[model samples]
Target chain A: MFKVGITSLCLSVLLVTSINASTSGKLLLSGGVNQVEGSAGGGLTPWAFIGGYGTEDEIGANAFITNVKSSDYNMVSTGFVVGFYNRFEFSFAHQSFDTRDVGATLGLGQGYELKQNVFGAKVRLFGDGILEQGNLFPQISFGLQYKKHEQGRVVKSYGAKDDSGIDFYLNATKVILSESLLMNLTLRATKANQIGIMGFGGDRKNNYELMPEFSIGYLFTRKFIAGFEYRFKPNNLGVATEDDWLDVFGTYAFNKNFALTIAYAYLGNIVLKDKQSSLYTSLQVGF
Target chain B: MFKKYTVCLLLLISCASTDKLSTYHDFGEKKGIEKVVDDLFVYLLKDERTKESFQRLNLDKTKEGLSNFICVTLEGPCKYEGQSMKRAHKGQEITERQFYGMVENMQKAMNKNNIPQRAQNKLLGKLAAMHKDIIGN
Candidate 1:
């Protein structure tokens, strides 16, 4: 499985290198960075923008790698996304969660890693978020993500009802050019526990919970933008409490094909740890 | 939460200084606008996405019209003797991509003309409102 993921990522990189100069449409920083789940968005949540520089007449794709590190845990996520004619988007991501010392305490061995694969699809419903500056309506989209955990039996023994789950979401986004600001709000219905890292549903809840996520950004320049995001989470696992996530981020576009994002994120509590604050970084290369 | 953000945004827009005179001066008034218009055409004609659309245009008339339009948008003392956006772009079949191509060209021109970010945004804010009429009517 790991080998497959690596090979696909390599192919994605090659795709980017070969096609970047030919693909151009969306403005700089308009597509947003690759979120943890591999969608086009902020570091922690998905935004309504499709996933690349593609215009309505063009097809665009990109590959990204992200890392988040805290005191007791580290996470690395890699993915590729394709945007079709700026209307529909398809994405795939592989995530690895390192338990570090906490793995030893749980008898799961030191530096134990949990792996998950996410596949996502999104379709634009209506509205032009960027160009239609005269209107108040935002660009909206509907999306779904299917996630599969590698260690199904291990998570089930810890009270997870399933190791795989689906998440449905609606996103609204607007770019108020007058203020050089961008705003996005996403509503998601999910049954996953800790984003399906530890498992899906648990003893506390088996039904899906609706959560809200928000991102607000100010464009300081055509090449630079800074923002804030908050994502609500569902605590489906009774054994460990889950908390909401928030981050303050800034992304700088080195050019049309390369962008770097850095953020300070608060993941609240994860499993046995509390007040998990960490540094998050991501690099995106696309057309 | 969305409602609160809307209210905040409205407040910010209202509180922003709307001194058009200062903004116009930031662009060095009429002379600066002409320079920007000239540079704008250079970029627009060079960009592959927009070059064909503008290749047949009457360069001098378009430049004068654009300069006048921008001057009036900045609330300067110029009278725009040009056609309305709807009429000007009618039957042109412009795509969203082409529209954005023009926007980027305008940005490049503004940067070259030493226009401040705030002034540029103010100008774009007004022009962006006309996109509905300019794009694929």
Candidate 2:
């Protein structure tokens, strides 16, 4: 896990080395940092802005490394993203979930782990979150993410229905410019259990569910932002009850190319651990 | 079911959003706005991305117009008697970068003028609505 995070950062640094001259761009922090799934937006809900540092007529790329640690477990997620013409985006993210003692207790092993890869794409459907001062409609985006979990044997032993699948979502982001407020609402259809850490389905059911996620932020400056996020997860596995998640976070862009983020999250549950709260942090470099 | 959905929708709509005009006016009185406007031009003139567009600009008129614009936009006791926002930048070929650059300068000016973050953001929020109109490209 440690090596994975280091490699993610190294790759991001390599990605940022090739810089393309930029044109006009979105407000700082408005394009959003890389979400856990490697999509652009809040720490959870993806925003409408295209990934990377590009504006409308230019091209840009970015890389991010994130780590979340708690008393019960730890996780590392990292990925790279490319934005084309500020209208479309493509991204790839890798995540490692370490079960620690819980895996041993669950009869798996002392150091069992679950790893997954997520590939995502998004398009700006319509509206400009920053410009709609007079309009009620917010900027909207449609996105799809395909998630595949490794360690299929462990998931199968736990009664998972599948090891790979896709999650579809539509996001609406609005900037109440006068109020200096940023808001996002995401509607997702998914069936992964514990985000596929424990597998896809269980005795409860084997079907997809429509869920809503949201984030609201306030810009302290052109370079700093503070916000809150909420995401509703599907409880496809019945062995352990799943809970919705929420977090309070802040992000600061040192410049256009690098940023630092910190957050305290209430992750609800993680596999067998209940009230799985944690401290989350990530570094992002974009061009 | 329909009534429940309507109520939720209305709640969301209300959640979508502010303070009244007078509270906003306190960010800067007329004198404060003048200083912020001056500081804004200074930064704009210094910014490489935006300096070119402002080179041939008229200083006095721009300052006077911007001060009034800020005041009136905040519903203060002043009227923006200048040309419309669109007409003022008609042929500048203003790119998105320049537009955002201008906003950055404005924020710096507000910060230098000792404007509180709350007031500065409120002012910015008011200006953000004009993003579409400000960009000529």
Off by over 4 Å in 1: A1-15, B1-15, B20-22
lDDT for predicted candidate 1 compared with the true structure? 0.88
DockQ of each: 0.57, 0.46
Report the Cα lDDT for residue B96, model 2: 75
The window of 10 residues in a row where model 2 chain A has the poorest summed lDDT is A15-24
User: Best by TM-score, which number?
Assistant: 1
**Model 1 agreement with the true structure over A93-184: per-residue lDDT tens digits:** 89999999999998999999999999999998998788778667899999999999999998888888998999999999998887788899
Q: Assess every candidate by TM-score.
A: 0.92, 0.88
Per residue, candidate 2 scores C-alpha lDDT tens digits across A1-287 of 66867876776666555543442365666678998889998887788878876667677777888888866888888887888877899998888887889989998787677899999999999987876676678888999988899887778777788888788999899987656678899999888787666667666878889989989998877788899999999876766788888989999998777889999988887777889888989898887
Clashes of 2: 4
In angstroms, the error of model 2 at B128 is 2.2
